[model samples]
Target: MTEQRFSRRRLIAVSGAALAVPAVARAQDVPAAAPLHRRNTMSFVPQNWQDHFDGLGIAAIVADTTSRALHFWSGDGETYKVYPTSVPRTDELTKRGYTEIVRKRVGPDWTPTPNMLKEDPTLEYMPPGPGNPLGTHAMYLSWPAYLIHGTHDTRKIGRQSSSGCIGLYNHMVEELFAMAPVGTQVRII
Candidate 1:
């Protein structure tokens, strides 16, 4: 065989192009108005997530901050659901721990947290409605000052754009609220 050599910069460029091809292809395959639930968007799921799910005998909620996705594994362990989610924008604000659902509400109100108000004093509490940031449902977590809630801004889903909470699409949150009762274990990774 003949000896061959490749430049480092050429290898990096070729590798980047190879990685981008799949993302471009996936984007083209998805319809413009299609909901994320109907799309194949689990590219960010951890390789060993299924192994953890297999060991769980109880229902659980798992959030991967890096992936910006939430997984609901049923008690049966054989069934699971994934939802596109928006997580805290900064690593400092993203928390990882074991907690449980403390409460659940429908058409939840939006009261700006103390930190939020400090950022913008003009912000006011919002009543439950379409315009509310907490769109249709909210699940309070055992951890203080944290929650998993629906968002009115659908464009933010699958992104890192929240203050310190997990945000889901309205319909997906509604479905999740129905399936996840109070006291469900929530593990953030």
Candidate 2:
């Protein structure tokens, strides 16, 4: 009876430790909001916008609204990275156009736009932190109030959840912010 009790306790402890390993590994895979310059070389052939950007020698971003995916292309025309993103939620906010990065901010505070405030009057300014809607970093677009920003709610990625801005996972946005400088061309389709 003593030997069986000891074995059961040992097994429970071992099982708990085993369950912890994958959690630790997953945590390590997420990049912190630091200046990390790692390149993501995942490739996908552009379905709709390839002809528009083929042979273009400038670093650019292309967002596919249908797939809710963002593709970053290097100067060489190869996809540097691909990340799941959240796009505009409503038809009025969803439109395709050309834009450029107007500004970049690290841990940016979010002020609700006029439209947002109209929709939710109680919404107010959000200071930078985990609770902030604009998580970690943001790259504002020249297109008025639109932006490519990180989100605290990572589950929103790969869905249409934002008013108009593009939302990436916090870790992915950190990597993208490091790669995309201001004035980088962005084309949404």
Candidate 3:
């Protein structure tokens, strides 16, 4: 596919506008910057993922349609997923079971990539395969390129290992697909 370049100024404007195009309350997953010393390790295990899932206080699942299931749930600093979905937080509230109001659109040209990818170029722009943290699936949050998805590596699932993106297992993500609609409520704990 042909690539289009969005000027930084334009990107900033567009991102800002994107915030308004989709109406929503502030996302729950946004967290204060962590201490530079590191609070905990980042992992992509089912147990950790589950803990994060349950942490959202069971309000609504800000589901990550991506293969990586990290953003599958929302929580506090312990498991914060960035760019939370702007859609409704519950199926009971609307006809649409779930919907992502602002999914970060990523093509060949994207700006301000995740910290992990920025720190490690080998990981970013990698082809689909082992070590590709993007995994086989990626359901993006409203934040650009930030997603709740699967991972090629399972060890990094639960912790804050991504560049503001949620990570999960490919198989687990397939299961997540059956759970709801495109507009489902996604509440980051």
- Name the candidate that leads on lDDT: 1
Deviation (Å) of 6 in candidate 2: 36
**lDDT of candidate 1 over 1-189, digit per residue (tens):** 997789999899999999999999999988879876755543467533454444554568898887788988766667678888989888888888888799999988888889888878999989999889888999999988789999999988888888789999999999999888787788888
RMSD of each: 11.3, 9.4, 20.8
TM-score of 2: 0.72
| TM-score list, all predictions | 0.73, 0.72, 0.41
lDDT of 2 at 186: 88
* Whole-model Cα lDDT of every candidate shown, in order: 0.84, 0.82, 0.44
Residue-level lDDT of model 3, residues 109-160, one tens digit each, is 2234565456666553555555555556555654455455566666565433
Residue pairs in collision within model 1: none
Model 2 spans with C-alpha error above 4 angstroms: 1-50, 54-57
What's the distance in Å from true for residue 178, model 3? 3.2
The order of the candidates by TM-score, greatest first, is 1, 2, 3
| Superposition error at 122 for model 3 (Å) | 4.8
Backbone clash total, candidate 2: 0
Candidate 3 or 2, higher TM-score: 2
In model 2, which residue pairs have backbone atoms overlapping below 3 Å?
A: none
RMSD (Cα, Å) of candidate 2?
9.4
